[model samples]
Target: MDADATARLLCVGDIDMDLIVRVPAPPSRDGKVDGRRIAQTPGGMAANVAVAARRLGTRTRLLGAVGDDALGREALAALTSEGLDLSHVATRHGEATFFCVILVDDEGEKSLVKVMSPAFLPRADEIMAAAFAGVAHVHLTVARADPGLAVAAMARAAGATLSLDLEAADLPADLPQGGGALADLLASVDLLFVSDRSRAAVEPVLGPLTSEGRAVITTRGRQGAMLERSGTRTQIPGHRVPVTDTSGAGDAFAGAFLSAMLDGADDATALCRANAAAALSTRAYGAQAGAPTAAEMAAFLDVDGVRDA
Candidate 1:
């Protein structure tokens, strides 16, 4: 647990399986459209980030829970094969695992539907100082307030940087949109990742969110991403590739971005690398399927030249 020996990234949030379907185009309400199930893979923002970071040559740890159901076993099997430290993952016996159904169009745009189970949330008490041993950064998808707060406090205490990604579930009646409470929560975090769809969730209180030493990254798909810091914004262009699915592109970016940061890469350089990693991940059907390794990422950047040069 020596400080200098710690080079791991941590992800705390959900883990579930995804069923991907490729449609001619997304169907309108009540409009039947024929499609094919392209793949069923392990997903969930936290899990995706962990896999992506791990592939990019960082030791990663995943702190989440899964049900004891078949889907949970499958998801655990996939994750176990990916080589992440899941020693802290909880097993909710008799509970059903969460399921995500992704509908990707021929154009690669995707809409997702989540089937939630009564799966348990890993309580804050379950998180321990040992879990932060040798942990450098914690990428978190905001879950229940107590657990999220525990993670933030412990991560800060470990002198590890904190990153928060707000999912749709945290928009209201939840953590991200907690107004003053949200600002206080984010005060301890170092980075924030936002998708275009969740942009408005923090727009109203963005000022306070970034007032301290916090930075915000908004993933804009093909256009790449934007980094906001101290009221100024830097635009990072994306690499263009034949996209197969856009489901986990943003999560990939989050993972690679953290990987770069852990390597001591600066904001701009990290953004470029992360943008490229995200573009490469879309070359396959599942989120983790096409994630690039460290060498692959390096080769991609060499060819792509770290932005549209």
Candidate 2:
């Protein structure tokens, strides 16, 4: 497995307008303070991962929705410049696009508030099994479980590897506690990315997925990441970098890790590459702005003494 012009990878989920504001500290309710800066950028779990993978020279595509509004147009333009295939993306009429307000504090920690549009719940007619044809890998930033199941079924028929990011899913609120339909959908994936904060809540339902022959990578912010697979687990220490905003670091890690694995990198090598990419992503303010290209990533790895594993 290697990335080339024909390496078809698809990311399915949200695409939003991210309004990022930098503040000295977390704001209190009904209290306001002058912000250092504010900027609008394209963001969303699937969109960010698609951009990250594109930065690594993978042939990536996005399958999601946005409103037929200016914000949606802006996001489309940004993704287009990044070279992601948007043929399957939908434009919903009479609806506002999804938007998120991200507040970054002095420590680069963030708090986000999101507004989702009706378009976020894609219509059944919009999903087509043929879309998965020839795809080598399919990643879902699952906000809705049903669509993910639909896509996974298609991916399975196409013989593509399936991957998932759990943060996008509305978890405990939407799924049954004792491992229901949602758990079944998650179990079908080849790779799973979970944040440390959500680990405890999720572990009970998913159990040790790696022990079942699936790869699970846990993202632990500044502490780096850990990979568990084939009954073995390894901790990949995070790199120390000048942190600006940690908004898209996890997305960077997921995308880079998937691309590395597709490129035939071994477990340790892939985890190291992912950590390097994620640490480098924190050098800038917005999620997509700081992502490095393949060559840039190679140089970063060399400088950081993580050339390959």
Candidate 3:
């Protein structure tokens, strides 16, 4: 698998409109804070990752649900502008499009409030069967409804490699907490991307992962990332960049990493490329706006010490 080989990537999960605002600082009780600026953009964990993959020179397709409203139209337009295949995106009437309010503080940390449309969360079996057709890789951003498991299973059944990112914070108490159900899902995924915070929450339920055909990656913001497969563990250090927004850094990393892997890059090379992509994403104010092109990422990699694990 040469780095230039064409790879078809199918992304499944949330699709939404984002309202990103930069504020001086978070307001305290009875305190007043002024926002610096506001920008509306097409975003959603899965959608952002798809855009990142496309920017990195991978053919990408998106499968998700949205309302037949103005926001949904805008999101579709954005994905189209990026050359993402949206033929499978379903739109329903009488439902508002999913959206999120992202507030970035002066320190570059972010807080998000997400509002989902009732029409979202398509039938997992239908969406998975259609999206997995002829795809080389499948990446799922865990939705509030936990659609990734079914999608992953389908991808595996089709002989396509599967990747998963756990992005949702809310889960039903009765459901397998953390990595219990997550570990079971891992049996089908070739790669797993999760936050370090999430690792702690999930560690208790995680069983001994049989890395027969799988790699597990946990990202520690600023500290870089860790990769575990089989019994081997490797830590890749983070890059230093003037941070503007950390909103979509993780999503960018996941996309870049998958793209690199599809290009036949080894685990270390993939982590390095992913780290550079994530670092570049923080140099701007919005999620997708700051994602660098392949040339830019390559140039950044040329700088010594940027990728030294």
Candidate 4:
């Protein structure tokens, strides 16, 4: 199924203001060191994916929340600038917006500390079914189970294809254990973008997926991604390039893969495009700043869409 101009995609998750600081290396054992502070940038798993897909010329929509405060306004303004449909994004009157402190080392590897509030997540009951009208696809970032279930049910009802980016780092403290929560959510999507870091926790539940005709994917930094379907695995090589900040490369991969799928590209072709997009995204700082446009992506690969090697 190819997505045309009228095709719509919905992204659901948290939106945040990121404070990135460049440090020589992680401070050791209470060691104090000075670092250069980068300017605040608006990004979050769901929001970043939305921006990436939107950059590739998809008509995208974002469903999440932010505060009415200045920082929240700044973040919302960023999404608005991307031309994403923010009609379902809520504005909490008195609460503070979620934010993250990302520390990047010389090698562009990062460690982040996020300050999130359950209050910032959208509730399932508050969502109107009418909000999803005309949406052809739904991609969910890590969120509370109930809301994920709600969205999944609606997507099924609307006959929309569903996918999820279940990054291990984003899993809440309580939900990462056992095969229960992950398995429950896994049942909702036909495609999952899991991290290699999550394989240990994610593997046990994956057995059922392949048997059910679902696919599970794992993204490896600078090593491209691997896709598993029907118990068969395909390793797609990554594009190597000069690295700057690796912050949003994976999100770029997820977004680009979804965009390619919308364009009717096969899995291997989509992953090659996604790898190229992720590599290009590391050319600059911040997650969304370095994301390449469709033209940029096409030029880099020197081909519009090449099939697997």
| C-alpha lDDT score of every prediction, in listed order | 0.82, 0.83, 0.80, 0.80
- Model 1: residue 173 alpha-carbon error in angstroms: 5.6
* lDDT tens per residue, model 2, 18-81: 9999988877989887786578999988899999988897888788899999999999999998
Q: Which predicted model would earn the best TM-score?
A: 2
**Best by lDDT, which number?**
2
- Where in model 4 is the C-alpha error above 4 Å? 1-7, 172-178, 204-211, 303-309
Distance (Å) between predicted and true CA of 68, model 2?
Answer: 0.4
Clashing pairs in 2: none
Please report, as a residue range, the 10-residue window in candidate 2 with the lowest summed lDDT.
Answer: 1-10
Evaluated against the true structure, the overall lDDT of model 4 is 0.80
Which runs in model 2 stand beyond 4 Å of their true positions? 1-7, 172-174, 205-211
- Every candidate's CA RMSD: 3.0, 2.6, 3.4, 3.2
How does each model score on TM-score?
Answer: 0.91, 0.93, 0.89, 0.91
Considering only N, C-alpha and C atoms within 3 Å, which residue pairs clash in candidate 3?
Answer: none
Q: Quote the lDDT for 140 in model 2.
A: 88
For candidate 3, write residues 38-82 as lDDT tens digits. 789888888889999999998888888889899999989888888
Off by over 4 Å in 1: 1-7, 173-180, 205-209, 307-309
lDDT of 2: 0.83
Worst 10 residues of 3 by lDDT: 1-10
